[model samples]
Target chain A: MKARVTVSLKPGVLDPQGRAILHALEGLGFSGVTDVRVGKLIELELAEGTPLETVEEMGRRLLANTVIENFRVEPA
Target chain B: MKSGVVVFPGSNCDRDLMVALELVTGTRPVALWHAEAEVPAGLDLIALPGGFSHGDYLRSGAIAARAPVMRAVADHAGRGGLVLGICNGFQVLTEAGLLPGALMRNAGLDFICRDVALEVVTTDSAFTRGYRPGETITVPVAHHDGNFQADAETLDRLEQQGQVAFRYAGEVNGSARRIAGILNDRRNVLGLMPHPERCVEEAHGNLDGRRLFAGLVSVLA
Candidate 1:
C-alpha cells in the first residue's frame, strides 16, 4: 500500500509562489484564471492496511507545518 | 560563552557561526551533529546555522527539524537556555514548533541576497540586548524562502509582548510587519532570516552583528 499526502498552505496564508504562477498564466494569455495555489504531493510506501492515523502523524510531524500549512492523506 | 553550533547534514554556515561564536567568546563552540540525540552538556547557547538542510527537500528545514538532535535542541530551549536560529535555522525552529509562524517563498519569486537595513524592535531579549530599541543596522540576507506569516492575533501578541526582536527598516521579503527577527515567547529562543554571523567582524564591513554576539556572550556566559 501507499499513502499520498497533499500539503497546501493554509487558507488565508499568503501563497506568493501561487500568485506568481497565476501571473505567469495571465501573461501567457490564459483567461478567466481567478486563482492558483501551489502545494506539494508526497507519496509514501506503507504496509498494507496501515492506518490513516499513522500517515496523518507524518503530516503533523513532518509533511506539513501546521502553523501555515494543512495536509491531507489519501490511499495511494 | 559556552556555545554549541548544530550541524545538520547540509548546513553550510555552521563554520561561519562557529567562528563568530569563538571570536566573541574566546573559545570554540562544540560542533554537534544533527544525528546526536543530546547536545553537549552545560551549553549556554545553541546556534542553528543556516543552510539547505536536508536539502530543503519536503520544505525548508522540514527534514532537519525532525533530526534526532532537535530533540536536544527543544530540551535546551525548554530549560531557558538560549537558541538562535538563522536563515534555514529559522525554518527548522518553526517547523520544530519551538517558534511560531512559517517562512514561505519570497513574495517576488526571486532569490534575494543582499544587505538590508533592520530596526531593533526590542532590546529586552538575550539576543538583542546590545542594541537600543528602534536602532537601525545593516545585515546581509541570502535566501529564497524568508517571508514570515502568521495569523493576525498571534502577530498582535508577539508585538504586545515585545517578542518581535527585529524588523526590516524597509520591506525585504514581504514579511508580516517586515519582521526580520523574532524571539520565542520565553524570550530565550530567536529565529531570523538575516545572517548576522556573516557580518560579525569589521572585515565583513560591519560591526553591527558583532554587538549581538558580544552582548549575548557577556550576559549568558
Candidate 2:
C-alpha cells in the first residue's frame, strides 16, 4: 500500500514561498491567480498491514510540524 | 563541564560550537553524530549548532529533527540538562518539540545575514544571566527562516513566565513579539536564531555574545 501525505501551512501562517510563486506567475502574464499556498506531497510505500494510525503517527512525529502546518493522509 | 555538540550531515557550525565550549568551559565537547541514539553520559550541556541540516530538505530542520541524535537531545533536556540551539539549531529544537513556536520565513522573504541588535528581555534564565535586563547587544543572525510564531495563548504564557529571553531591539525578522530567543518551560533549554558563538571574542569585532556562555558556566557551576 502507498500513503500520500499533503502538508500545508496552517491558516494565517505566512507562506513566503507561495507568495513568491504567486508573484512569479503574475510576472509571466498569467491572470486569475487569486492566491497560492505552497504545500508538499509526500508518497510513502508502507507495509501491507500498516495501520492508518501508524501513518498518522508518522505525520505527527516527522512528516508535519503541527505548530505551523497541517497534514492529511490519502490512500493510493 | 562536559558538553556535546550534535552533528548532522549538513551541520557546518559544529566545530565552532565545540570551540566555543572549549574556550568557555576549558574542556573539549564531544561531537556526537546524528545517527547516534544516545549522547555520551555526564554531559552538562548539549549544543545544537547551526547549518542547513539535511540540506533543509522537506523543511528547514524538519528532516534533521527526526534524526536519531535529536531523540537523545530531547531525553537529555527532559532530565534537566542544558540545551542551547542556535540558528538552524533553533529550527531543529522547535521541530523536535523541545521549544515552543515555529520559525517561519522572514517576512521580507530575504536571507538576512548580518549583526542584529537584540535586547536582553529576561535575565533570570540560565542563558541570559550575565546580561542586564533590557540591555541591547549586537549578534550576527544569518537565516532565511527566523520569524518566530506561536499561538496567542502560548505567547501570553511565555510572557507571564518570563520565558522570553531575548528580543530584537529593532525590526530584524517578523517574529511575533520580536522574540529573538526563548527558553523552554523548564527554563533549562534555550533556542535562538542569532549566532552567539560567532561573536564570542572581541577580535571577532565584538564580545557581546560572550556573556551568554559565561552565564551558562555560572548557572551550571
Candidate 3:
C-alpha cells in the first residue's frame, strides 16, 4: 500500500517561498494571481491493510509540525 | 557543571560549543553522538549545536529531532535538566516538541548570516541569567529558517509568562514579535537562533556571547 501526505502551512502562517513565486510570476507578465502558498508532498509506502489512521499518526508525529502546518493523507 | 554536547552527523558547531563550554565552565564537555540512547549520567547541561542536521531533509530539524538520542534528551528535559539548542538546534527543539512554535523560512527568502543585534528580553531562564533584562547585545545568526511563528494566543502567553528570552533589536528575520530566543515553559530548555559559542572569545570579536555560557554554568552549578 502507498499513502501520500500533503503538508501545508496553516492558513495565516507566512509563506515566503510561495510569496516569492507569486512575485516571480507577476514579473513574468501573469495577472490576477490572488495568492500563493507552497507545501510538501510526502510519499509513504505502507504495509498491506495499514489504516489511514496509522499514516495520519505518522503525519502528526513527524510528517507535519502541527504548530504551523496541516497535513492530509491520501491512500493509493 | 558537567556538560555534554550532542553531535549530529551534519553538525558543524559541536566543537565550537565544546570549546566554549570548557572555557566558560572550566570543565571539558562530553561529546555525545546522535545515536546514543542516553546522555552520560551527571550531565548538567545537554547542548545541541548548530548545522543542517540530517541535511535539513523533509523539514529543518525534522529528521534529527526523531533521532534515538532525542528520547534521552527529552527525558532529561522532563527531569528539569537544562537543555540548550542553538540555531539549527533551535529548529530541532521545536520539531522535537521541547519548545513551541516553528521556524519558517526567512521572510525575505534569503540565507541571512551575520552579527545581528539582539535584546535580552527576559533573564529568568537558566541560559539567559548572565545578562540583564532589556540589555542589547550582538550575536551571530546564520540561518534561512529562523523566522519564528506561532498562533497569537501562544505568542501572547510566551510574552505574559516571560518565556521570550531574546528579541531582535531590529528586523533581522520577520519573527513573530521579533523573537530571537525563547525558553520552554519548564524554563529548563532554551532554543535560540543566535550562536553564542562563536563569539565567546575575544578573537571572535566580542565577549557578548560569553556571558550566556558563563551564566548558565554559574546558575546550574
Candidate 4:
C-alpha cells in the first residue's frame, strides 16, 4: 500500500514563498491569479494493510508541524 | 558548569558551542551523538548548536526532534537541567515540544545572515541573567526560516509569564512580537534564532554574546 501526505501552511499563517510565487505570476502577466499557496506532497510506500490511523500518526508526529501546518493523508 | 553539546549529523555549530562552553565554563563539554539514547549523567546543561540538522528536511528540525537522543534531552529538561538551543537548535526545541511556537520562512523569502540588534526582553532566566532588561545587543543571525509564529493566546501567555527572553530591536525577521529568543515555561530551556556562540569571543568582533555563556556559568556552575 502507498500513502500520500499533503502538507500545507495553515490559513492565516503567512506564506512568504507562496507570496513570492504569486508576485512572479503577476509579473509574468498572468491575471486572475488571486493567490498562491505552496505545499508539499510526501509519498510513502507502506506494507499492505497499513492502518490509516498509522499514517495520520506519521503526519502528526513528523510529516507536518500542527503548530503552523496541517496535513491530509490520501490512500493510493 | 558541566555541559554537553548534542551533535546531529548535520549540526555544524557543535564545535563552536563546545568552544564557547569551554571558554566560559573552563571545562570541556561532552559531545553527545544524536543516536545515543541517553545523555551522560550529572550534566548541568545541554546545548543544541545551530545548524541545518537533518538537512532541514520535511520541516526545520522535524526529523531531528524525533531522534532517539531527544528523549534523553527532554528527560534532562524535565529534571530542571538547563538547555540552550541556538538558531537551528531553536527550531529543534520547538519541534520537540520542549518549547512552544514554530519557526517559519522569513517574510522576505531570503536567507538572512548578518549581525542584528536584539533587545534583551527579560533577565529572568539562567540564560539571560547577564544582561539587563531592555539592553540592546548585537548578535549574528544566520537562517532562512527564523520567523517565529504562534497563536494569539500562546503569545499573550508568554508575555505575561516573562517567557520572552529576547526581541529584535528592529524588524529583523517577521517574528511575532519580534521575538528573537524565548524561554520555556520552567525557564530552564531557552531557544533563540541568533548565534550567541558565534560572538562569544573577542576575536568574533564583539563580546556581546559572551555574557549569555557567562551568565549561565554564574547561575548553573
Candidate 5:
C-alpha cells in the first residue's frame, strides 16, 4: 500500500518561503498570482491493509507539527 | 552542579555547551547520546545545543525530537529537572512537546547571524534570575528558522503566566511578541533561539550571556 501526506502551514501562519516565491513570480512578469503557500508532500510505503488511522498518527506525531501545520493523509 | 549535554548526531554546539557548563558549574557535563534510552541519574541540568539535527530533513529538529533519549529527557523534565534548549535545541523542545509554539523560517527568508539586543522579560524562572527585569543584553543569534509562532491564546497565556523569559529589543526575527526565550510552566525548562553559550566569556567580546548559565548554577547549586 502507498500513503501520501500533504502538510501545509495553518491559516494565519506566515509562510515566508511561499511569500518569497510569490515575489519571484511577480518579478518574472507573472500576473494574477495573488498568493502563494508552500507545503510538503510525503509518500510512504506501508504493509497492505494498514489502517488510515495509523498513517494519520504518523502525520500527527512527526510528518506535521500540529502547532503550525495541518496534514491530510491519502492512502492508495 | 551536575549537568548533561544531549548530543544528537548533528549537534555542533554540544562541546560549546559542555565548555560553558564546565566553566560556570565547575563540573564537566556528561555527553548523553541521542540513542541512549536513559539519562544518568542525579543530573541537575540537561542542555540541548544547536545545529541542523538530522540535516533539517522534513523539518528542523523533527527527527531528533523522536530520538530514543527524549523519553528520558522528558521524564527528567517531569521530575522538575532543568532543561535548556538553544536555537535548534529550541526547535527540538517544541517538536518534543516540551514547549509550546513552533519556530518557522525567518520572515526575511534569510539566515540571520548577528548579535541582537534582548530584554529580560521575567526573572521569575531559574534561567533568568541573574538578570534584572527589563535589562537589555546582547547575545548572538544564528538561525534560519528562529521565528516563533503560536496561536493568540497561547501567546497571551505565556505573557500572563510570566513564562516569557526574554524578548528581542527590536525586530530581530519575526517571532511572536518578539520572544527570544521562554520558560515552561514549571519554570525548570527553557528554550531560546539565542546562543548564550557562544558569548559567555570576555574573550567572546560580550559577557551578557554569562549570567544565564551562572544564574542557573547559582540557583541549582
Candidate 6:
C-alpha cells in the first residue's frame, strides 16, 4: 500500500513562494488568479497492514510540522 | 562549564561553535554526532550550529529536527540545560517543537547573507543578559528561509511572556514583529537566525556577538 501526504501551510501563514509564483503567473498574462499557496506532496510506501494511526503518527513526527503546516493522508 | 555541540551532516559551523565555546568556557565542547541518542552528562550548555542540515530536504531544519540527537537536546533542555541554536539551528529548534513559530522563505524570495542590526528586546533571558534592553547590535545572518511566522495568538503569547529576545533593527527578513531571536517559555533555550558564533572575536569585523556567549558562560558558570 502507498499513502500520499499533502502538507500545506496553515491559513494566515504567509506563503512567500506561493506569492512569488502568483506574481509570475500574472506577469505571464494569466489573470483572475486570486491567490496561490504552495504545498508538498510526500508519497509513502508501506506494508498492506499499516494502520492509519501509524501514518498519522508519521505525519505528526516528521511528515509535517504542526506549528506552521497541516497534513492529510490519502491512500494511493 | 561542560558543553556539547551537535554535529549533523553538512553542519559547517560546528567548528566555529566549538572554537567559541572553548574560548569562553576554556574547555572544548564534545562533538556529538546526529546519530547519537544521548548527550554527555554534566553539560551546562548544548550548542546547535548552523548549516544546511539534511540539505534542507522537505523544509529547512525539518529532517534534522527528527534526528536522534535532537531528542537528547530536548531532554537536556527539559532538565533546565541551556541550549543555543543559531541560524539553521534556530530552524531545527522550531521544527523540534522546542520553540514556537517556524522560519519561512524570506519574503523577498532571496537568500540574505550579511550583518544585520538587531535590538535586544529582552535582557532577562540567559541568552541576552549581556546586553541591555533596547540596545542595538549587529550579527551576521545567512539564510534563505529566515522569515519567521507563527499564528497571531502564539505571537501574542510570545510578546506577553517576554520570550521575544531580539528584534531586527532594520528590515532584513519579513519576520513577525521583526523578531530576530526568541527564547523558550522556560527561558533556558534560545533560537536565533543570526550567527553569534561568527562574530565572537575582534578579527571577525565586530565583537558584538561575543557578548552572547560570554553572557551564557558567565551566567552558567
DockQ winner? 4
Per-residue lDDT of model 3, residues B1-221, tens digit only: 99999999899999999999999999999999999897789889999999999899888999999999999999999899999999999999999999999999999989999999999999887788899989999999999999999999999999999999999999988999999999988899999999999999889989999999989878877
* Tens digit per residue, CA lDDT, model 2, B70-133: 8899899999999999999999999988999999989889999999999999999888999999
Q: In every candidate, how many clashes are there?
A: 0, 0, 0, 0, 0, 0
* Chain A TM-score, each candidate: 0.95, 0.95, 0.96, 0.97, 0.97, 0.97
Which segments of model 5 are wrong by more than 4 Å? none
The runs of at least 3 residues in candidate 6 whose Cα sits more than 4 Å from the true structure, single-residue gaps closed, are none
Each model's lDDT? 0.91, 0.91, 0.93, 0.94, 0.94, 0.92
TM-score of 6: 0.97
Each prediction's TM-score versus the true structure: 0.98, 0.94, 0.98, 0.99, 0.99, 0.97
TM-score for candidate 3, residues paired by index: 0.98
- When candidate 6 is compared with the true two-chain complex, its DockQ is 0.88
Interface RMSD of each: 0.7, 1.3, 0.6, 0.5, 0.5, 0.8
**Candidate 6: tens digits of C-alpha lDDT, residues B1-221:** 88999999888899999998898778889999999997789999998999999999988999999899998999999999999999889999999999999999999999999999999999998789999889999999999999999888989999999999999999988999899889999999999999988898878989888899888878878
In model 1, where do residues sit more than 4 Å from their true spots?
none
Q: DockQ of each candidate's interface versus the true one?
A: 0.92, 0.70, 0.94, 0.96, 0.94, 0.88
Residue A41 error, candidate 3, Å: 1.1
lDDT of 2 at A73: 92
State the lDDT of candidate 3 residue by residue for A1-76, as single tens digits.
Answer: 8999999999999899999999999999999997999999999988899999999999999999999999999996
Candidate 1 lDDT (Cα, 0 to 1): 0.91
Chain B TM for prediction 1? 0.98
RMSD of each: 1.0, 1.6, 0.9, 0.7, 0.8, 1.0
lDDT of 5 by residue, B4-84 (tens): 999998999999999988988889999999999988899999999999899998899999999999999999999999999
- How much is the lDDT of residue B155 in candidate 6? 92
